[model samples]
Target chain A: MQLQAEEYELQFSILVKRLGSWLSGQTGVAKAYVTLRDSQLLFLVVTKSTKYDSDFEDALSDLDIELANDPDLRDITLSVLSIPNVPSDSLSSFMHPTTNFEIQRGGNDG
Target chain B: MAETTVKDRLRLVERNHDALVALIEDARNPHDEWVATIAFYKAIQLVEALLAKRHGSVSTSHFRRLERLRVHHKDIYKQFRPLYNASMVARYLCLPDEPGSTSVAYFSSFSDYIGDAKAAIINGRLIQLEALVEKGLGEPFTKTRV
Candidate 1:
């Protein structure tokens, strides 16, 4: 499933290059990070906590999409609810970055 | 023949993870951090497989165990810098399937990526994760849609 063939995630910075306006439109947070592994795309969407819920609510409202739990998340379903509660230090324990992938060198502490 | 169920795989992984945890707790002579890194990810894929398969048999307790495991693993992966230089996305997820998407350029091949750096091994294996994530990135992924 890893798309080593084309290196799409590596090109994700290209998304920033080309889709910044589109992204800012979708997320008023003004900060987002997208990474890919093989075929799996890891989208790290961040916003101020104040902005976080509002933006998410707004985005879904505009799209008229219902936010319900389903199979697409059938695998990662557990951690989905747990993320908001993630404390700063526990972030380090994952053996991965604290949150989403960083868009810049020093963004996410990893 | 006794074929392995995703549940069986999960149990094996839990066993292996516990074994590694014991090694970490050893008092006499602690192994280098790299040894633990391998153990962490080896255990990761087993859980990844169960989650990926979406086994019907997984229970609330199972999810709880998995959650504890994932958060801790996330903490461990955060410890190192990429052996090579590259751009990546910040961490955030819109939904359950989307485990925070971002692009990263590192060792494309596991073996070649590590160089002589002992710590680089983990980055090497992270190379395979894309296979898992790409499956859930977009509209096809938004769990509720299904």
Candidate 2:
């Protein structure tokens, strides 16, 4: 069922946190961030391993049934982002500087 | 509907690669952050082509594209995540306060803000993808029941 924009974000964030917690129990998963953007569902994960082999495929596909059955999320396009274990000190390094710059750029575009 | 031939798919891969190259060339112009954002998206398309060739299907959904990438092509996924984040930054998401607000002047200085290190990371991703494409998508695997 569809929800208001605010409600959707709240529900989606809750779903993401729950899914993230469940995924953390699986081997090799460091973290998972479930988010919806532009009508697509994104599963951005950080992992202990960088391999997307048969084993990892199994882990991802295992979610299909659960995700497909969910009333709020089943209809959207789903995507994933898997990254290797990055040191905590370097975590912020993953974000684009321009993104931050753009936000802080503010009314100073002149 | 007639199934798309391998030749046709390969042609699409070539097109994606060509577009990526063009975006890279465009990124060399001034206002690089703006250009780099576009380049990152083209890079995603290029990876999608590679993944499509491997998987025998294509998706218009970004999430599905990334999901399959992580499931099937881990190597590319490693190179792609940061680029994807960078693209998100370029397009929207990961902002300090206001979102989706971008300007050349603001991001022009971003090159200096990131200095050489982060720039290297961004350029490094493109290089890795280019190398992968030059290597070509290898033989497709036949599925077998586990």
Candidate 3:
């Protein structure tokens, strides 16, 4: 029973929103977004700290466990970058995609 | 930006592989953190090379690379995830031991913190990945003199 492309996209969007809400509450995560690059889905997390501290690692480990346990998102790949790692132009590029969902600092939905 | 060819990616793979070998063979000090990091980057290059050769384009990011592997090459993905996690631990969490503190610790001994055993495990995983890459690319991946 293969899902239609539209149905799959809808499901993906719903899941991303739920994940974004969960990520917004996570400590040390300043922002999180999902973007399609080269036809592949990417979950990019931007941490508040410039360094990879214990808090960031804890949040990352928790996210990994959560993603692994989720049936739908277990197979999805995720990337975590500190604020310093993201280039200025790339941030805009990440936000350009319509499918992208960003949860900014202070839990502001973007 | 110019698109990277398979040759360019493989060249980067070779360079990282050479650096891994050099770091492992260095006699002065044992820095397992660096060893883990280099091994992971080498694996990254190998994956990128495979993607470029097979799909005609490399991944735009780390997660994209892993996603490409997960969808197209599950075996490589399985081998890569542990290496990725290990490197993250080595780079960020495995801190140096402090003196005479009797608190519960994640890693107690200096060896436990990215030690020889951990380094050996990471190396073994890297070799497994290289074998897979060689099978896919039909070329030798390890070019270290030692």
User: Each prediction's Cα lDDT score?
Assistant: 0.33, 0.48, 0.60
Candidate 3 colliding pairs = none
Against the true structure, candidate 2 has what lDDT? Answer: 0.48
Q: How far is candidate 1 from the true structure (C-alpha RMSD, Å)?
A: 17.4
Query: What is the per-residue lDDT of model 1 for residues A41-78, given as tens digits with 9 covering 90 to 100?
Result: 33333332311132343342222111112222323221
| lDDT per residue as tens, model 3, B23-87 | 87888966667777888898888888888777888898776676577667866765666567557
**Which regions of candidate 1 are displaced past 4 Å?**
A1-14, A18-110, B1-3, B32-35, B52-146
* iRMSD, all candidates: 17.6, 11.6, 11.4
Query: In order, what DockQ does each candidate have?
Result: 0.05, 0.07, 0.06
Q: Is candidate 1 or candidate 2 better by DockQ?
A: 2
Q: Write the residue-wise lDDT of candidate 2 on B1-146 in tens digits.
A: 11244445445545544554454455345443554464465566566556556666766676666656655666666566556654543343222333234331122233443244224434556566556644555534111110
- Ranking, lDDT, top scorer first: 3, 2, 1
Q: Is candidate 2 or candidate 3 better by TM-score?
A: 3
Q: What is the clash count for each candidate, in the order shown? A: 51, 4, 0
Comparing 1 and 2 on TM-score, the stronger one: 2
Candidate 2: clashing pairs of residues: A78-B63, A78-B64, A79-B63, A80-B67
Q: Relative to the unseen true structure, what is the C-alpha lDDT of residue A84 in candidate 3, on a scale of 0 to 100?
A: 21
Best by TM-score: 3
